[model samples]
Target: MDDPLAWLDDTAQARQAAGLRRVLAPRDVVEPLVDLASNDYLGLARDARVIEGAVVATRTWGAGSTGSRLVTGTTRLHAELEEALAAFVGTAGALVFSSGYTANLGAVTALSGRGAVVVSDVAAHASLVDAARLSRARVVVARCSAPDEVDRHLAAAPETRRLVVTDGVDSVDGGLAPLAALHAVCRARGAVLLVDDAHGLGVRGPGGAGLVAEAGLAGEPDVVTTATLSKSLGSQGGVVLGSAAVIAHLVDAARAFIFDTGLAPGSVGAALTALGVLRDEPERVAALHRAAAAVAASARSAAPELGVADPTAAMVPVVLGEPDLAVAARDACAAAGLRAGCFRPPSVPEGTSRLRLTARADLSADDLALVDRVLGEVLPAVLGRTGVSAG
Candidate 1:
């Protein structure tokens, strides 16, 4: 009784010492700051059409989903969203989930089991790793961002039913997976390829369909894709898209799909509207890519010593070697009225903490200029004593 909670105190102290003390600061929606951290790639979160759709759907269907989809949760709105999403992404069918993380978990665990082997990229999102852990699958972590490693892993485990899982776009580094090659490897190994296109949808591919489509792997018989509505759709849910039979299996087998609360009508409506908007304005995707490239270019020009991976989508990471420096750089940006995302250990496999800057279609050139100025000032201080120069 004297020191029952002593371990908690020590853990907190250790985290604090390493500059990893996380905090929750609720932000004011209308704060005067340049935002470069949000996942709203298409900037439809506040669009009148998107907001109005949510409002109408909420007024018509109520606030919450009220029950699981198997109960009273499968609204007509959800059906419409599923249909639209499937068609948009070039898949035979789609099933919406509460969140992207849950979608990944549901898809992976349902598709893989004890006798199965999941050849996952070393740098996949935490959700996929968690899904693999829960599946009791023989999880093999291949090389970071290398499809060849996936092939090798599959080759080494020829007897197991295998699934090659990866993020279409690396959330931290903004690098794209070699999805076409990965799919080829999967095909050669008779494995299934599951791509989590959370950061790819509404930012890449034809009319922002996704990276799987961009790589010409969409609708492939052995390929499955998962995406989040929260990112570019400006909504709050996730979807798994694949062949009709695969989706049907998920409906019957996935616990998350069967037991979890369905996506609310409002989110379903918003996502549907966002998809329409994306179709009507394909240029938005192009703008997002351009903005991301511009930001990456600026970072490279201003701080060449900083490892700024070339962005294939809206995500851009400015690599800071240490967690303490990353936090300091992020704070410096915040102080200068710029909001940026910070990524550290566990989230990044490289063990190099970074400032993750995400570009939105709504971010003007002026906003990017502010990002440049803030980083120019903060990066130097963060990289102290090295006296680094831009390449």
Candidate 2:
């Protein structure tokens, strides 16, 4: 008989031919390179206090949550985290989920149904896109940077209930969404606005509350926010912040939350400690922006035509517009003792593959100087092959 999975080989060959074959290249425990690829913006992933918190939680609550949250997983730490997050973000309540993806799923699906319409940002993360698909609602796409177009979509929808969803920060290109303007449009159209501020938490807004709060939209009746603890907080899990009614509804209606196991106890503890650290050291947020700007400036210096945007968060994307050129540039950086993110198709639009460099608040001046020197060498060589002139 023919192999049942023989089609997989054909698909793999197709991917290989297109320069889209991916390899799982795990790093060594002690990589002696300047890191610009990780999402640990605050450098708290391995902080002494954060580690101690994890240890204490593990000792107190064991390794796993043991059950779904509704059954037996709602530990005191979870409750405390929920309350603290709501308070921090200026929301009436908060609900925690196992991951940011799940949080987005829960928030979108619970808030939208057959009669409701969902307007999603074109450049949003996959989580939001999948959430809109799973919502079983009519989905429309609009440019998140263009609030007027979103408003037009909402105005045209016949559904009485409408939802507008977008990222607080564009994950791939690191562009800040127009949160305030989007909220205004949603308000005018009698629609609800959901902002997934996964990249904004612990990196933007007052005391690192997030971009929703920074835009002065926090606690607004029609606005909801979702965020993750894995990035700037240097932990794991996700949370949804909104009115008390929304939180209660999600608890009852969100399948992702009701069916999935709760977030691990250690992650909850580590996140709590990280929150405390962020509260005490808000200046870390400023340091993070400085590092990102420095990286962007360096990348731009090498290929001025790359048009690297000034980042408001901890990410700087160097768009090379070709998958092989981007991969080559990333490898060249690795050879120069630097680790940069290689983003390609699906993560970004076709022909816009690039390097996504993240910044850490603790990156030293010497570290930045190294980035400047390395990008100055790596980007020009790669851009040359792409025929992108080095202005």
Candidate 3:
């Protein structure tokens, strides 16, 4: 009999021909390059205090959660992390999930069902897109950053239950969504609002509380926020923060939360510790914003034609508009002793492949200078330009 998976080989061949095949390049425990690719904005992933928190939690709670959260997976550390997150972000309650992706899945699926409508931004993250697909609601795609468009979609929906979902910040370009405007639109329609603050938490808002709080929407009965501990917190997990009723509803109804094992104790402990650090040392948040601005400014100065935008968060993109050029630019960066993330099709819209540079709170002037030096070498080759000086 013919192989049942032969079609997959054909698809792989098609991807390879189109320059879209993806491969993992895992880093060593001790990397030699200056990493501008990771999402660790606070630079706390390697901090001694954070490490100690993880170590103590592992010693006390063991290595694994071992069961779904509804069972034995719920630990004291989990509850502590949830409480700290809710309090930190100014929410009435919080729930922890194994990952940011699962948190989005749980929030979207649990809140919207057969008789509901989910109006999502066109530029939402992949996890949110998948969540919308799984929601079983009539999904409406509205233009990114356009609250008026969202209003029209919500007004036209036949379903009485409406949930408007959006990312607090666009992951690729690092531009903020119009949260207050969207919230107003949702409120006018008596709809619930969910903001995925994956990129906004620990980087935007007061004391790194998140964008929902920054926009003065925190603790609002109609609003809910989801965030990832892996990004700014330098840990691994996700959280959903909202009213007590929403938290209780998710606990009973969210399949992603009910069926998946809870977040590991070490991650929960580390996140809790990270929250304390943020509360005490809020300067780290400001430092991160400055770093992002420096990175974007340097990139723009080197190649004025590249049209790099000022970042509203920790990310800056150098759009190359083709997959091969993006891959080549990334390789050039690697050769210059710097690491940059490459974004191609699906991660970004077609014809907008680019380099994604992230900033860390710990980056110094010398580090920014090094980035300038590396980009000066790489930009000319990718952009076909001359006189792109390092200084």
Q: Which numbered prediction scores highest in TM-score against the true structure?
A: 2
Q: Runs in model 1 with CA error above 4 Å?
A: 158-160, 307-309, 385-391
Could you tell me every candidate's TM-score relative to the true structure? 0.96, 0.98, 0.97
Better of 1 and 3 by TM-score: 3
lDDT on C-alpha atoms for all candidate structures: 0.88, 0.92, 0.91
Top candidate (lDDT): 2
* lDDT order of candidates, top first: 2, 3, 1
> Residue 137 of candidate 1: its Cα lDDT?
85
Query: Candidate 1, after superposition: displacement of residue 317 in Å?
Result: 1.2
Per-residue alpha-carbon lDDT of candidate 1 for residues 1-391, written as tens digits (9 for 90 to 100):
5988889999999989887778998989799888888899999999999999999999999998999988999998999899999999999999999999999999999999889998887888999999999999888988636767777788889455888899998887777888888888889989999999999999889999998999998888799999999999999999999999999999988998899999889998899999999999999998998888888887887688776777878988887777887888888889998988998876764458888999999889798888788877777776773455444
Using lDDT as the measure, name the better of candidate 1 and candidate 3: 3
What lDDT score is found at residue 156 in candidate 3? Answer: 85
lDDT of 3 by residue, 198-249 (tens): 9999899998888999999999999999999999999998999999999999
TM-score of 2: 0.98
TM-score, cand. 3 vs. native = 0.97
Candidate 2 stretches greater than 4 Å from native: 387-391
